[model samples]
Target chain A: MDMKRILVYGELEKERLHPVSLELLSKAKEIFPESDVQFGMVLLGSGIDGAVAEAQKSGVDLVYLLDDQRLSVFHPEYFAAALIQAVKAFNPDLLLMGATYGGEELAPALGIRLKTGVAAHCTDLRLTKEGKLAQLVPAFGGKVIGEIFTPNTRPQIASIKPGMFLASPQEDKNASLSILDASLLDSVSQRIRVKGVNRKELSSLPVEKAEVVVCGGYGIGSPENWNSLEQLAGKLGGAVACTRPAIDAGWVGDESSMIGTSGKSIRPKVYIGVGISGATHHICGMKDAGLIVSINSDPNAECFNVSDFKVTGDGNLIVRSLLEALG
Target chain B: MNIIVCVKPVPDPDKYNLLTIDPETKRLVREGIPTVINPSDKNALEEALRLKDLYGAKVSVISMTPLFSVDKIKQCLAMGADEGFVISDRAFGGADTFSTSYTLMKAIEEIGTPDLILAGNESADGATSHVPVQLAEWMSLPHITNVTVTEAFETKLHVRKKTEEGSVDYEIDLPAVLAVERNSNQPRMVTAKGMVAARSKSIRVFAKDDLDVDESLIGLCGSPTQPGELIVPNLKRASQELKGEPEEIAAQIITLIKKSGVAVAV
Candidate 1:
């Protein structure tokens, strides 16, 4: 049997390989376990020596490095062009990237340029009987998981959600690297120019990266009441999060920290929801957390349905008491 | 400028609890659930209408859904879309975003390439956010997603796109596709006069034969991805309804927390 080649697009943040890239590398091994399958990586960005070193330890067969100053900050058109060039060079049978802001933009752009099929936010992937890739994803707001395929399209593509797979690095004994000259990608213009970037600083750890997250909702009542939740989170050694309504009401810092379809999706070790009436939008984001415990006054609050532990009581009082008890 | 906005009718998220998965067919049981214009698609249409108001552009709306979605399309018309089209056909059922983009791209081609094409960042149901870029690629036009702010000029468009770390502003030439992010603009409400005008405004239905699309690339049969085993997560949780005063409840919660291995001192 011929080798079934796979390409993993390693995302870079300030010259370091994003952890999701390693997770995708781990996932590629699980999806294609056959001995004939070869894994390749396309790492794009300037000053990527650290990333290149990490890729060496990833056990991939080949590394296509496209490093340039113009590629420092992600420009969708430029990044997509670089990726398409690598695709043509390696001609991999499968392509995977993290379903992140950059990956979401680049993957579809390639689908149009390559005229291939792409499955976005795939939760699972497998090789079919006919040697095609099968993608499994949540649909209708995570109400159902739909199996997807791109049978006729060459180089079937998928963007896996970050945190869906665990990252386990295995160093390769025989690994080779090839640096693709960025100047060759002159055909792709930087059509969309980035004038400025105003970064949102998270005073605490990002909710997605936190091991334990204590989330508040309208039940928390006011921005002043958030102090108690924050204290509770502090006592638990976790970060503080909130629902869309809390963000809308100015009880939370920003939408980036909100838990919902419009905000960041989190899969922490423990998720404690306070005063939240679980909307589907919010549920979809935190449903995958390891353990969910909810406290709400209203017994009928939807948050109780998906929660592993439930408490029927006033949110503020309970939070204050918990803080007092922790002391 | 002529602008086209894509809208999809989705089950009202308020009733998502009533949603069920068909054990055998592996599809959403959406029979009794009323359909509403997807929330973000409304934002897309609202953006288009704002452009029409400021620059006097013509805004048209399109959707690929069952014939039943005609009513939802009319809702778009009632919200000030100049025209509406429903690309409905039995053959188009169960299409992933790729095939859906193919069919929508064909519709856009048939309708003529407007100066700008707009879509919601993603559908509430699919939440893929792929159509805008995929369709733009099919048309070979420039595109952007997660756009929170937009300013249209005579020859170009300026947009602010949202990222995980921050927001970046971009300037792109006209004749591009854009996926409008949620909360970009508040969708206007349906008015009495707009609803009355919708009575005479017709929603054109297009089938597979209506456009220059290859037969194998229009529906589930042409779709490269196929659905496999269905897995509905068991979301049921253990129950312990805390009774009594706030102090007692807080003690119980602390006990539960400590039991979960969190090193909370009591």
Candidate 2:
């Protein structure tokens, strides 16, 4: 049997392994045929001992670690250089990472250096009958899902979103851990200087961690109509969320409060969608919500299909009525 | 300064509902949908044009699309791009972000060394946000994505990039690529005079052989990722239409909400 190599870029957040990285390991184990593949993980950062140990516990075959101070903060130039050097050294058959801000910046850069193709923000991944990797991505404004393949590229690359897969079971496996030499550190040309960073304090009830969420979409009509939804959310003790359209229309503040492929993925206990047309992108963000209740004027609105209890009525009028009835 | 803005013509996002996936080909059926410059790319072009207006600079727009998208390219020209290039060819069909950026890299090399390159953070259709960084890597240039503020100096650029947490400011040397986020700047509409000038302003078209590129690396053959079986998502819902007047319907909605365990004090 021919052995294939799979390398997952394990992400670390504040010296801990990101849950999404474990999710990738879980997915890598399930999708790639176990008998014919070696699963490994690559970790890069300063003070990565904890993450490295955590990676070993995941039961992957090998763990490659590059510890350096320069990697403490993410510099695309440094990160890309290190990743490219590792790829050249390992020559894995597949590369996987989360479709995160860091991954989004790094994956394409890596693909460019390797002269290979990369599929980004993938929702699903599968191995074809011919044993090629297939990446399912949302395209055409999230109206259709495109199943993409990289037939000719070596180390087929894909960056996936979170909540797409679950973490695998932890079992005792003799895993080899090796730290790479710092030779590539000299090649990094830090061109961009980070002057400063200004981070916003997430709202008390940030949508990503909220228990209950009230979401509004384009069908909400105007910014003025947002009040009705907010009122409903206030009464229901839920945080307010909106789709991309609402954010683009300035009804919602910034991209953080938006729920969709480009925004945040939320799995609240209850997600109430008001006037949402249910684009595929919007659904991906909130699909994992415990129970979905869609209220749209159009009965045929796409949001209803995924809804547990859908009310067909005008969004603005219905929300106001719901609020008044509660009062 | 020489600034090149990468623009993509995407299916009008407003008509996304009309889109369908070719179950056999597993590709978007974008035949009749109207095409427009992606929303953020317009912001990118607007930022480029603003730079051109402030300091003397030439803004050139490049897009990889079919020949049918010439009008969309001209729209950028009308918005004040000095020149436009469309790397359109049958061979370039079904090129993913990597192939698309490789093609753009070749076109950029042929266009000459630019002081700066700008593009939308992500395409409205693909939304990969990969082209800028990929192009930068192909050329070995430093790049940043999700830039909300930009200031150009003689040899470097001052930019504010948006992160998941907040924003970070940076100063990148010359010949770097930056992907602009939405609201970077409001894109200008085409004026009649601008339209007339666009008619005379030449738009260059690059075919496969126009630049030094390996045939194996130019199109589908060069593309590493290919599509597998496409699954059409089942988005059907059990819809319940609330009957009667607004008050009566509101009462029923309240009942459902209360039953769901979200208490209503009333």
Candidate 3:
């Protein structure tokens, strides 16, 4: 039996191997245990020697380094050409990437080039009994899990969502690294240039870092009533957070303020959700909070199921009452 | 200027429902759900149309899906795409992003390189936002993601790329790839004439052999990633009760805050 080789795309950043790369390696190990699972990584950009050293520590058999001044910034065309050339040279059975902004765009484009089934936002992966790739992805806005398989294809490709799998633990510092020169076609007119890269600062007082979090939902109504949540958060020596609806209503910024799938994922010590109906998207963001407290009007709200403490009442009235009681 | 907008048909996010994995079959029970164009891709189409209207460029829509997606191609034509192409094959099933990009790159090569290749920032189904970037890589063309604004110049293009904190402006040469943000522009409606023209337009379909692509490098055989398992996180809520009149309730809230030892300045 021929050994299945797996390739994980993306550069290994200094001090951190891209999470999805580790996840792919982890899944690859599980799927092709008996097969010769040679993990390959593609690193682009200058000053990636540190990254190359880190990739060596991640248990990859070979690292394809495409170090060029033109590859410093993520120019799609150039990177894709390099990747295609690399894949053709070192053919692998599967290609996995992180479902980040860059990964989403890169994955489908690769799918088109390869004329293969490219499953995006895959949350789960496994090998079928018939020895084919089985990818489980969310079918409808995370409402359904669709199991997709490629029985008759050679290299199955997928992009894994962040936080879907655990990044592999640091291995022994002595893993061997083989560096291969990834020949990239040079370009004359690179379309997009990164004039400047600005990183968004996470909230100064992130709810995730807070020992206590006081969150509000749409039931609080009007931005004016937000004062109550602030007061509660202030009293608790914590920060305030809001559901996606509240954030979308322009009541809060993306940082420290919003807690949901699209926003920050938090696990505070004490999380109090006010008037939150406990949608899955919202709950997944903070379900791991140490002590959960929910105050809502609906008796059968899903929030009750996960809360350590439950209060059935209108959010506004209860918040004000709590404020008065605190005083 | 000629443009090719790559669009994909995905299952409607709103209509998605969880299926009970028959522990035995472990397959989704998708019996009665409708699919639609990915929301972001719709925005991409709208942006394409806007560019055409602004500069009178010819726009072609391209996609790769199962044979069932022919209706989606027709819809794209109705929406004002000058032409359409579908790359569908049984062998192409269950490919990852790498293979998908390879297939799309082949189509782009066949369609003849255009001045601009427009795509949505992300698909609702995948929402990874990597396809356009990958397409750019395959074509060896400059590309921009999270595009909010696009202005075509005589010999170059100017665009604003949306970042997490703010937007940055860039001026790139022609023949670039751009992934537009979903909220960048409202897609225009299909005109009556466009509907008629679309009906007359032919959709070009290609198989694995149509493009000079290695079958091993095009599909599952060439993909590197696979989804392992999917467990939908369940949502649970708790309830609280505050018994009192309006003013009394407000006062009670204050008391509760005080009792919790949280500060509340009245």
Candidate 4:
């Protein structure tokens, strides 16, 4: 059997290889074993030597390096042109990229330019009986998973969601490198230009790291219930999270406190959802918690479907009782 | 300046649980569920309206859906879209992002290319975030996705795009596509007066034969990505109802949390 070549687009952030690139590398290995696959990487951007070094030893077979000063900033047309050439050079059967902000933009552009289809936020991937790649994507707002396949396209493209896979680096595996021609980027239009960047200063450890999360939703009623929910989280040494409706209700000050597809996906040891009706988006974020407890007045709250323990009562009474009981 | 905003009529989010799949066709069953203008698309239209206010730009909202959602298009008009266009036809059903973008691109071409095209970063139902980029490719124009802020000028546009860490600013020449992010702005409500005004306005409707479209690349037939077996993720858990009064229930929940190796104050 011929080798099934795979290309992983290694995204760069300030000359460092994005961690998701390594995760994709490991995922590619998990799906297709070493015996039947040849893995390659396409690393772009100026001052990408650190990234190139990282990619060379990450168990891939070849590295296509397209480093240029003009490539320092991500211009869609320029980067897409270089990527199109790099893609043509490697001619892989499968292409994967971290579904980072940049990947989301680049993947679809290539899908159209390469005349192939692209799948985003793929949770799983596998080879079908006929050797086609099946990209598992969430549909209907994370209610179901659909197997997306590009039946007639070459280099079947997909952008895997970050944090879904683990990155176990093989530090000893070194790959040969090839410099891609950058002249194609010359003919590309320079219409889209980067003017500035404003990096946000993160203030605290993210909610995803907390073992216990006290999540409140719109049904939590008033800001007083929200305060009790926060006090409950504090007493338990956990963190406070809110649903999208909570945010929309003005109970949530920022998205940092929100738990949903628009916010964060967390797998905490214990998740207590208060007054949340269990919207599909909110359930997807904290559904994997080890212990799912839902406290809502309505017994028919859809969140009960995924809860390990369901409490049908007053939100305020249950939360206050929980706080007092914990103390 | 002229602007075209791509809007999608999606099933009301509150009724998302009623959504199921037609296993044979792999199409979502949206028959009974009432449709609403996708929330993010509302922000996209809001962004266009803001630009219209700033630059005296003409804003036209477009959608490719069953004609039943004409009310939603009129809702866009009520929200201040100068012109509302719906590309409705049986051929446009069951389209994936590729075909959807191609069809929308063809419609925009028919409407004449505007200086800028805007759309929601992703539809609430699909949430793929693919069409904006694909539409730009089909139209052969530059595009930006997840745009949070935009500043328009005579010959160029400056936009702040949301990234993983923060945001990066970009400048694009005229004739580009922008996929606006949700919550970027508070969308205006459709008032009674706007509704009355929209009632007198006629929305332009296009069918398969209305615009020049390649027969092979219009809908499901044009989409290359086919959906295989669909499975609703099993969210089933131990449905143990913590019985008794609030205090007792709290104790039981605390016990369960403690049993799961969580440390509680008590």
Candidate 5:
């Protein structure tokens, strides 16, 4: 039997294996026929015992670990070098990483080093009959989905958003650990250096993980109207998200709160939009919600075409009334 | 000091709805949609200009476009760049990020390397966020993406890069590439005098023969990734309209919210 091996590059958040790694592993196990293809993980870091254990719990057949003090902080050159070493150790057919900020930095560097194409911010992945990975990517201002393939490359590579796939805990399976060489870091260019880091702890659930999201659009008119929407979100026990205009207007300070083509794609249980005209970019981010309701004064707003519930009225007035009614 | 800033002309974000995809071609129908300098790239140019102001750095703006968008880089000159170059050639058409990055690398090589190179972290259209690192790898330079702040002194540079949560500060070597993020600074407006000066400053246009490049490593041939299939997203929904008095509509929304089994504090 021909053996095809897939590798997931484990990323960490505050010293723990990020959920996206397991998410990618779960999705890979579901898609790849287990009898034909085996799964492995390549994890690189410094003093990451916890992350290694979490990666082992995912039931991958092998785990390639490169642990050293040089990797405690993320240096793009060192990180890519360590991953290259791990890749050599695993010799996998495909590499997948979460499209988080760190993943974004590392993926392209490795792809370029390996001389393979890297898909950016893919929403979905599947294996073609030819056994190539087919990446579903958004394009054209998020109006179309492009099925992309790296036809001539070994170890097809792709980066996906953290929340794009659901991660289910797997029954623990013993994974053999293969430690990579740490000496590879000596010759690689280490021009990038981390001077200081300031990581702010999130105060609440991010919009991507929020079950209910209330998105305020450009037509919200003023910051006062945004207040109504925020209160409405608070009453609903949901998180607040906004479009670029809201962020540009200084109504929203947190960059993570914005949802659109350039920002996070959310799949909330319920999405309530206020004064959103349903621009193609904004709709692309939230069209997959379980329930979508748009409140706009313009009855002919394009967003209504895709909304599960369209409430045509003055947006701020309706939100205020909703706030009061919920109270 | 010499610096190179990369720029791109993308379809105006405000007119995205008018843009469509050709069913037969499976490509964006950009006939009537006007093009504008990518928004974040302006931030990149502004940062370069700031460096020029502080250290007498010479800023050269570069881009690869299919059309003779001389005015695109001309606008960059109007924004206080020292020089501008537009690499437009029919041979460079249909290139993806790989070829595009290689082409830009050739242009950079032709002009000569600068102390620093800057580009927007992500393009408004492709949104790949790939070029900065790919070029860094090709040229063997260090790079930082999503850079919110940049400061350069003798022999070294200081950068503040934005993470998902907060920011991390880095001190890299003199010769480095940085991807400037959006909202880093407000791009200065083009003054009438600057525009007048730009008209006389003819942009250096490079065609296929100008730069030393491998024909196989450029244009469509150099691109490793290919779009296999294209499909318009399914956005149709049978929507239920709620039109009535404000309170009544709000009550109906509550009822629907309750029925959906989503938790509601009120």
Candidate 6:
């Protein structure tokens, strides 16, 4: 019997594995069930002793630790080189990375170095009858499904988008773990220096985290009327979101507040869409909302299909009418 | 300094009302969809042109798509790229981001490295936001995603990075790859002279053999990921008529929130 091992790259901070790392482990278990699949996680940076122990709890069979200060900040070249070295050494059948900012940048470069194929923004995974890795990805603007297979490559690479998969809870607290030295610290390059790190604070809520969300689209007319939706959201105790059109109109911030495949993926409880025509890119983000209410004047709008409830009338007029009825 | 800008021709998102999928086949029936250069990538091209105006650097454009996209490449040429290259082959079809990046790397190698490379932060079609960073990784160069402002000096590239919460300014060494946000700058319109020049300039076309590349690694056979399903979410809305004054309607909304179990202080 051929052994199939999968390497999941993880970040451990203060002894706790990042949530996405555990999600990868669970997914690997599901894909390679018949083969003897052991989870090998790579931890880069210092103060990860506790993280190594946490990997045991998450069912990681082996942990590769590359403890060094140079890896504290993710530099594409250094990280890619190190990952390439590790993959060459382990020769795992598959490599998985989280679709975070760092992973987005690192996966492709590593793929090029290893001379393998990489599927970006993958939502599902499975193994083919021929024992190759099969990845489910979106194609033609998310309008068509394309089942992709890496027939000629070993260690097929993929970056899984966050929130696409559910992470399984640890069944046992005492799983066996073996720690190995990555020993690739010498390849770290200091060509690029992190002069400073600064984070910004925005006013609107993250669409993904909102319990109730109100989104406006091109049907909102202009940037001036975006405030009306904001007023409505304030009254409803929810946040104001927008489709890709509204973001292009400069009515809302590009990140966090914009709802689409290119922006934030939201799964709010009650999503009230105002004037949104429901483009596929925008609809994919909020399709999981518990109850969706769409309001648009276009009787034949696409947003009507995914919505639980719909109103075919002017958004401003409907908002005003609702406000009046509430009084 | 020489620079290269990569662009993709995608279906204009504004023109199509709703993409129709064959319930049986689950594939988009693209019989009559009008396509255009991706909006964000237009901004990247505009930035490259602005840089050319500032420093008189030569600019080139590259695209990987079907033969039909060459017309869009001509449109890009009219927007002022000194030259253009179109990479099209049957083997390149159904490529995921990783396979796409390898093909792009081959094209870049054929064109030779430049002082800078620019692309849109995300394409409307895939919206993966992975290609630029992946390209940077492949080239072993520094990259700044979601850059709002870009300035080039001797051996240094300065930019304002877009963060989740706010923006931060940073300076990285030159020969870096950048993915510009659509909101960062407005793309300029094509000029008459540029259009005339675009008509005269010849666009170079390449197949799988034009560059030194591994055939198995350049197409669908090499890609590790595949599209499982495309679901057109049902976004239908429920209608209710509110017959009352503005204040009464507002009060009713408040009541509905309370009924829905969302707490309100007022």
State fnat for each of the candidate structures: 0.67, 0.76, 0.38, 0.88, 0.80, 0.41
Tell me the TM-score of model 1.
0.94
lDDT of 3 by residue, B7-93 (tens): 999866544433334556655555565778887788888888887888898889899898797888888889988888999887788
lDDT of 6 by residue, A229-320 (tens): 78767766688888777876678765668776666667777788889887777777787777677877788777787776666667777666
Indicate which candidate wins on DockQ: 5
Q: Mark the regions of model 5 whose C-alpha exceeds 4 Å error after superposition.
A: A1-3, A129-131, A169-171
DockQ, prediction 4: 0.68
List the candidate 1 regions with Cα displacement exceeding 4 Å. Answer: A1-3, A126-133, A172-174, A260-262, B200-202, B242-244
Candidate 2 residues A1-327, lDDT tens each? 122888889887668888789888788778865665878888889998899888888878888888998787667887777787667767788899987778889998888777777888887787667765668887765567778877666777889876677676856786788777777888667688777778787677777666678899988888779977887788877789998878767887788788887787777778889988888778868887767888888867888888877777787887787788878
Give the lowest summed-lDDT range of ten residues in model 6 chain A: A173-182
Against the correct fold, how does model 3 do in TM-score? 0.69
lDDT of each residue in B122-231, candidate 6, tens digit only: 88777677788767766777877777888888887777766543555667787888888886788888889889999988789889878777876667665655555565
Per-residue lDDT of A3-27 in model 1, one digit per residue for the tens?
3898999987668888889888898
User: Could you tell which candidate, 2 or 6, scores higher by DockQ?
Assistant: 2
CAPRI grade of model 5: medium
- Reference-based lDDT, residue A208, model 4: 71
Estimate, for each residue in B1-266, the C-alpha lDDT of model 1 and write its tens digit: 99999999988866766778787877668779889888889999999999999889888999999987789999899989999989988889877777888899999889999999999998887788998888888787888898888998888899888877788888988898899987788899999999998888877889988888888777877776666766665666764576767788778767766676767666
Better of 1 and 3 by lDDT: 1
A259: Cα error in model 6, Å: 0.9
Report the Cα lDDT for residue A184, model 1. Answer: 70
Per-residue alpha-carbon lDDT of candidate 4 for residues A1-327, written as tens digits (9 for 90 to 100) = 233898999988668998779889898888787576889999999988889998998899999999998788777788888888889999987789887778889999998898887888887788788866788998767887889888877778888876567677564778999999878777988788889878776525557778889899988889888899988988888889998888888887667667766667778899998889998888877887889989888989999999988888887898899888877
Question: In terms of lDDT, which candidate is stronger, 4 or 6?
Answer: 4
lDDT of 5 by residue, A1-327 (tens): 123888999988777888889999888888875666778898888889998887887889888898888887777788888888878777777889988887898888887788888888888998778766789887755776788888887677889877778887765798888898888888976587789888877848788888889999888988888888888888898888998888888888867877877788888989999988888878888888888989988888989999999998888888888899988
Candidate 2, TM-score vs. the true structure?
0.90
DockQ of every candidate: 0.61, 0.63, 0.27, 0.68, 0.75, 0.40
